[model samples]
Target: MDRIKIKSVTTLAEHWGALRQADVEYRAADGSLHHLKREIYDRGNAAAIALFDPARQTVLLVRQARFPALLNGDPAFMLEVCAGMLDGDDPFTCAHKEALEETGHAPRNVRKICNIYPSPGAVQEKVALFVGEYDAQTRQAQGGGLAHEGEDIELVELPLDEALGMIESGELTDAKTIILLQHLALERGA
Candidate 1:
């Protein structure tokens, strides 16, 4: 607090998410004062889960439309692990709910993997990541995502090795999904 002084925070835009510009002064490493202005997007925190089936050696993921990615000249449809905003729920509960809603499988033995700020430079979103086991017995719904929420999701099941290969082929580009997959591989000593 002594090193950083926040001069003012002005809301630039407010809609589905908030955009604010912060004017601040910072003490540099050499004890020099530096003034800076930064714009931040606040969309709240979220949770994500990777569902792995040991018996089948497979992983469950979802594909959905992402306008931002399309705008960036990437594919509009992105393949990613199950994830959703916390919506005031705890991370663990959000993880489970997102899993069930997006993957059609309620995971068992859910375990926390890590927490990450995917885009800390501009967005104030901390995602809680988890890995959990799933099998035939866990299928509880069709899990196509909520249509009313403008989500049209496609469920995808891939062999672990194939999924890893997709990462190399540029097919799987979502950061959270890649992290969870690599974490699982590390856990398996692969």
Candidate 2:
């Protein structure tokens, strides 16, 4: 299908000093007039990276408290890859920094896997996904996370097979994490 033509956009409200409620008019493929009410978030785009150590047969995942997951009835804390919002930095650089801060791992070979829009319907957050194969020996810190940001992440090293099992059992709930795992399991055959 071709792109829809945006006829007009009007701001209706703003919330959290960041979210914007807007009304938009557009012409669909069939030339029908339609209006959409959307909640837009002016969030800076972000990136996430999955790190694997083939020799160790392990993947480094971060465990953190997520309010949404907690409220969604997930008893187990999330097991996710390193991720953070971009801040006037390149995707790879930001991902590398996130990995260090969140998992205490310095990524050696970061490769872009894909870019995705987490919530195109309402939010303007975009995620640049990456995969990295890193040396697992440098274990400088235990990855208590960046304390100043109130981040209390614990880096968990799981065997690739166990991580894949977590994915199949719906234990890993984070979308970007799941995407990375799926890519590894299917495309890379890792």
Candidate 3:
């Protein structure tokens, strides 16, 4: 922050999320001052969880429609780990809630992997990543996400190896999901 100086910020939109145009002067590494304007999307922070069943060597995931991806000419339906905006809860709580609501599993031994800014150049959204263990007994509900919220998610449980294969096959392209799956693979020495 010391190397950056804010000139001004103007709100451009605030419907689904806040979008602002920022005017800033930055001190370059070469001791030069540079002025620029950039639009930023502020959609708050989020949490995502990868639910792994160690005994079965499987992971639970959800497939849902993503309008943004559809708009980008990618598939409308995306296979992803359970995730949600924090709304007001802490990262761990949000991760657990989203896991239960999107995958029908109550996770245990949840551990944080890291925090990541998915689109740091233009978006102000940091997603907390976590890995949690799940089993048959943890399936407390038939999770398809909330109908009222427009989330018609489909649960998919696959062997860890198959899930990893999807990444190379272009079936699973979500960033957060990829990170979690790779983390699990590394953890299991796969």
Least accurate 10 contiguous residues by lDDT in model 2: 1-10
lDDT of 2 at 97: 86
CA-lDDT, candidates in order: 0.94, 0.80, 0.95
Best by lDDT: 3
Candidate 1 — which pairs collide?
none
TM-score of model 1 relative to the true fold? 0.97
Steric clash pairs (candidate 3): none
Q: What is the per-residue lDDT of model 1 for residues 54-84, given as tens digits with 9 covering 90 to 100?
A: 8898999999999999999999999999999
How well is each residue in 11-59 modelled by candidate 2, as lDDT tens digits?
Answer: 5555522676666676777878778777677667999999988677678
Which regions of candidate 1 fall more than 4 Å away from where they truly are?
none
**TM-score list, all predictions:** 0.97, 0.87, 0.97
Who is ahead in lDDT, 1 or 3?
3
Clashes of each: 0, 0, 0
Candidate 2 stretches greater than 4 Å from native: 1-17, 187-190
